[model samples]
Target: MSTGNTIPISDLITSRPYTSRSFLRECPERDPVQFPALWYYPVQAKAFTICSLCYNTIIHGFESGCGISFGSFTGTKHQTLFCMFGRPHPKYLYKKGDFLALRTFMASRTGLKVTTCHGLGGANANLSTTWYKPRNGEINGMVSCEACYEDYIAHTSFSSRFEKSAPQPAGQVWACDIAVPLIRRTLEACSEGARNDWRVFVAATTHRLKVPACEPYKERAAQSTRWFQPKDSLPGFIICEACYLDRIASTCIQGHFTSTPLSSGQIQHQKSLTCMLSYFPMAIAVQEVIFSENFQLWCEAAKIFMHEELCDGTARKGKSYTLIVKDGTGDADFNICQSCYTCCIDLFGFGSHFKQFDMKTHTEAGIAYSDWACDFYPTRYGFSKYMDALNEAVCVREFSVLGDFIARYQGVTQPCPRSTFVKGRRWYGTSDFSACPDCFEETIQGTALESMIVVRNQFKETECSCDIYSPSMRGIWKNACDTYDYAGFVELVRHRASVYWQTVPVMKRLLSQQRIRLMQQQTLNGSSMLYQRLDMSASASSSINYSGYSQPRYTYGAADVGYGYASTYGIEAARLGQQANNLVQSSRSDTTQVPYLEALWEAVE
Candidate 1:
């Protein structure tokens, strides 16, 4: 309902809009709702200045310079923001009020009854209630300001105690948490086949691209139904029109890193999967195979991600992938022992190290260094990274052979369920402790029966361990034999496509968890690969040039480095000490006896 009465709307608004912006050093609340919005306008813009205490009305603005019109003019500086008088909104002129009716009664009353004398007062009881109504009317349903109302409710909402566990007949019990599904969500990772086609994949995990509008600003915000780019091929720079305004107008930097998915004019070709691949560690190493470049600028940047003074190739001797650019001078080449040369070329990516060592005594000094390739090398591995690469290499050969075999044999592939063989039944949720349903039931029954026959048996003494004696567990083994879902996992294992689909997510999770553990370990160990490089540079005074190569003058890991990655690592080390204490305090005899098993489990992850 417009009151049909109005004043020139002051250049202000009542509420603030929230913005999460990066690279915004500071943002002041001053601008109008349009353009860059500010929380408050310096002046109400009514008169030169307005009332500060009650912002609803203007105070004095006659001759003060803050700007604009009318009324008694007092030539004062604009420093006093508000008028000394009471402030009320312009709407006050139109709001109508109602009057109250009279006389509801008010009185003081008392009543009593007789009782037996022994009952303490012939007194049955005496009661009195007092009420005073000077004006004989009722007042109720008074309203409060938004701030005061919020404060009142916040202070009074909980009747008595702080929130904790929900009350139950027992002390407290665990809530039934929502179960996370075992499926992997494949996001808009434009598949390999699509890369060669017109539809280009954009870098978006959260937001989707919307259809492009010729005049985007004139339109109401578009729905995320289509990509802005008209062409099938993705563009080199994938930036949205809206993102540009946010950066330049709103000072937001979030979308600056992302590229616009829409292409202009002719669609640029072949710009897909590369964006997804870039989000990986050693991305350059992976990308180098896709593109023919020996190196890219992005690769060089990533090389220094975790290590400094580290060569792109290797420092050990004998190994060379591509010859170092020698400026056409033969003297640029130097004599590195074969062992050193091999070590140099092999250790390339993150946490990726390799060594050819004497199998009998594989310590640093015992390393073969550059045996190059032993006949046994076909089957032998240098280190874990090398082993993975080698295993992959062998697989490639077998893959080709398998390809030939399949092509000639001409039989349809019976989709094989990978989960059946890739891991134990427990991994697929088919069985616990790697045993099938029947085997597990049989073992538990045997153990329970044999243990029950002993001298201090659970079947006889209440004093016997309740873990083996409890009535709740009495029929558990028998129940397992009858009601277990033996068919559910069996079906999952037999269906190749479904099993592999679920397995992919499980593998991805395991890899992620493993990576986190590795980073934590690297943080704790003072001699991590990155730390090793820093230690070597700690005392080096100056750079040394051998022939054409220039030595490093300073290690980036110096004490004054801006981001000291190692500084917070001590907290993790302290957490590790705490974990050790907890494990020591635990009473599991099996845990104490097989210490290496527990340690290996943590280390492997």
Candidate 2:
């Protein structure tokens, strides 16, 4: 337990009954009362406390021989100090200037101002009045809080470039620009080069920050400006100017790309362009290209990088060939495409686990064909775990170790206990619908419904109608949880289901008829009008909040609706109703339109 002059590990780690009410920023919710905490008071008015783990990790630097000991203080008689670091210690183990050297060394590293005001404890510069910003006064100029300025910039060669600024207005939150990765990288580069030119730094930072964001999967009707596409390779591949500068411009492979021409007129068709370097696997390929300085090799490898597109199982038209798990059964029937196999399996040395599947042959043999979907797609579940397992296998140099992890995903046919519905079992429900264990756990367990869940005993193995995948259901649950309105939640769910069943089919039919008419006309003007109407209808029905999550606008007529739901829903309902009436009237007025109902009746035969 003992390590030289240090305190025994057993003594330091022993559980204690005492608990502190105050919580540190690192562990904001609860105090880990069992471990000892170090409290530092630089002045009588201010105190900062850190748990033992933080003390060892950040302050003590985790050196084995480094230890705290009793020491005498020489400040003031009024200052009732416990330890040299501001805690009390036994006089028997006291040694003169025990922590003086350590404190001085730490102070030199963090700077005198930071040590005096914040001590070894961390500080948030945004809350401090002494934060500094660039003298140029640009709106997007670099700003560093007091702690950051002292700890990172004060000791550097370009320390004098910054000047103290007034604290932000009360209730307004501001963050140190140095916290941004790009800004931090720029600062580091300046430090490494020992560059004291403030103008150059500001210009570089401002220019980089002002560039448009990198959106690889953005679909535009016309060609985009300031974008780079690969020359003579990967036809639809494009990189934003920002991504080009940040990731590829400095590399030797930059010569392989050409600037995409700006659109001269409105384009009739939309094209989705994906940046090759933005995808992780392609980024790795680019890194390889950078190291080898071989652009052609990257082009060959890049052909297999499908930019997360789903494989359609078409040998001639598909971006990549379909790859299925060999001898797979039950849940192990993985339909990974060649792109995913290269990135997730072959790239990690697990190629032997899979093989190419002949989808054409299987279809000809009276088998149903489904489009190949990569189980390890970025957005799919278990993807993170699969990636972690692959990395771990590579790290340990045992490629066969991945087999056990992959086996967990195979040969598992039974639904999870949560998703299963059993007869004579109690389930959470309302009068209209009962949620399976899976649905309850995911959508209702921890919410306001926790107390209000109506337990029901099932008489038969009936399918649970609770659709957790429905965005409307999710939106309703979120709103209900936020407001804690159990009655409103039940009524809303029932109303939504009723309205959806009645409306969706009619809406689909109308949309289909409109699509056929536009196609028959074959005019750009007609297509534009149809798209405009669809956009208007969609916007009127659903509005996305600032957080980028879809906030479904449902029209509920419930009387006891809580927190503005009644008024909001009523207004949205009236608007949607008017739009629906207008659409129906337009369809009726179209004398030249084909009768879709008759067509559907004939096609059914």
Candidate 3:
């Protein structure tokens, strides 16, 4: 068989002791192939310094026809970076890859595909990827070449065309090493409860290994058989260990945000029923309860999560919960009057948003400012910064909830098949607009019936005199409605006596959405109840209090003392700009001023 000459891929992976600290501290590439993964194998202990050549290698590897060979180097200032050079030029026509999809692939893999396309070009390249192993010594930096590299080029080329213009995927090795390990560790800890070890095993093999197990090997490992398969019964890429374990959260297990099992009584057919609770106006506000002082102590008694939950009890209380707040722009004053709805959508998939308002109003005499508009008065919410904060908050909440919930619930200990809750409905703003299987069949069945009616009425009537609406657009909308069984529409007309021209259901659905907003606010009470709660600086929100205005004495004023008055009076400009900013500065000055004044008096004594 010439087995000795042919080195198996498995043999390429050698067992090397991996310690979080050691791996982080030193580049073990020279020691041996301790880590598993093609990108990280062929161990070499060198500081990762990727050059132009390495970049070209990555690009060429990803660009199917681009003839480029990549040489990766370690033991330098830059860790695990490769110099990509020379377009290898393909002999055959490489498929014109989907640039958009390739960009998506690069993004998903935490790699950059920087080509000559984007104006910035190679200047954007980072010397080190966060994925680079970080430690405390000369070897503190190590490249995750194979781990990040792999067949990334091949995958990126097919992913999307967007990768062509953006930065070529770099630092992916570092990203994979850092992100995957962190995520896997988190998942493994969560999956510890699963007796079969299926959750952790699947995560390690598929996500960590980034490959499928061969069929022959799967058949022999009987004792660990369950570990090889997905518990959810859906066949696709295996989830990472952390994500798999996080699924054990109580929300998933309790079916609060997911689907329920279909009973046999409902369907005579062999297929299972699918249901899901689709949320509306997808983007929701995440309100973190903030306290003025040490108010978290009352949380348990109040039966609410408070600011302390965000930090330790020793610190102040702070934490946020995802919720759908009503858009109050239509109201008379344009205020988001605290109306809210519970955010009941799944954690991943599509995401949500939190909307801010401009609460400024002008009076006849002058522009009178309200407390609501204070945050944005100077420079309306820094939109980008606000969005960034919102994203961080959401990520933290999603992961934290998953972690906490899994610990409390046992059903999610392993993958389990579950049914959809409400089929055919898509939330308006949140992601997950694509129609699922349940809606597909229903719409197909309804199409013929609808077509027949439209044909029958084609010649019977003239168009409406109003002429404001388009029958075609309405028809398209109707088809969309039919195709997607919107729970919003269903709830709008649930109590109709007849099917002809039903209106009550629609009104009810609208009212129901509003009610949700109110409930979101009323659920939690006590010191934590406030709208604008965040960790911004104290001075940014407070008013400055100074005993007197700074008045420089003028010699000329003495000449006119009898005829004129020396006076200077106005609130500090900063005090007017940001109330809290004044307070913080004022407090500091006051603290130091008192000591100075005391020292002066002592010298006189």
TM-score of each model, in listed order:
0.15, 0.42, 0.18
Ranking of candidates on lDDT, top first: 2, 3, 1
Error (Å) of candidate 1 at residue 448 is: 20
Residue 587 displacement in candidate 3 (angstroms): 68
Candidate 3 has an lDDT of 0.25
Please give the CA lDDT of all the candidate structures.
0.25, 0.48, 0.25
* Residue 516, model 3: Cα distance from true site in angstroms: 56
What are the per-residue Cα lDDT tens digits for candidate 3 across 1-605? 11122222222223322323112212222112211111221112222222332233334456434332223323321112221111111111123444444333333332343211111121223633222221222122222322333222222231121111222255432223222333334333443333434334334434434422223101222221112112332222122222222232222221212222324552344232111001111113111111111112111111111111211112111122222233432212111111111121222211233323333544456865444321111133222222332232333233333222111221111111111223222111111121222222123212422222211101112211111023332343355555664454233222211221133334344445545533433343211222113211222333244575433232111321221112211122212223444444454544554445445322321
lDDT of 1 by residue, 1-605 (tens): 12222221111112222222111111211110111111212222223222222222222332233232233322221112222122111112112111010000000000111100111011111211111111211111111122111112112311121122212233322211100000001111122123321122112211222322223212222232122221223232222343222222122222223334434332343222122111222222232222222223222333332222222223343332222222432111122222122222221221112222232334366655442232111122212223332222222222222222112211111221222332211110112212222222223323423222222100121111111122222244334434553344233224523433354445555555555655555454533444444434442434556798745454333333232222333233344544444433442432343444434322211
What's the CA error at residue 103 for candidate 3, in Å?
A: 36
Task: State how far residue 404 of model 2 sits from its true place (Å).
Answer: 4.2
All candidates: CA RMSD in angstroms?
39.0, 21.6, 34.0
> Model 2: how far is 78 from its true place, Å?
47
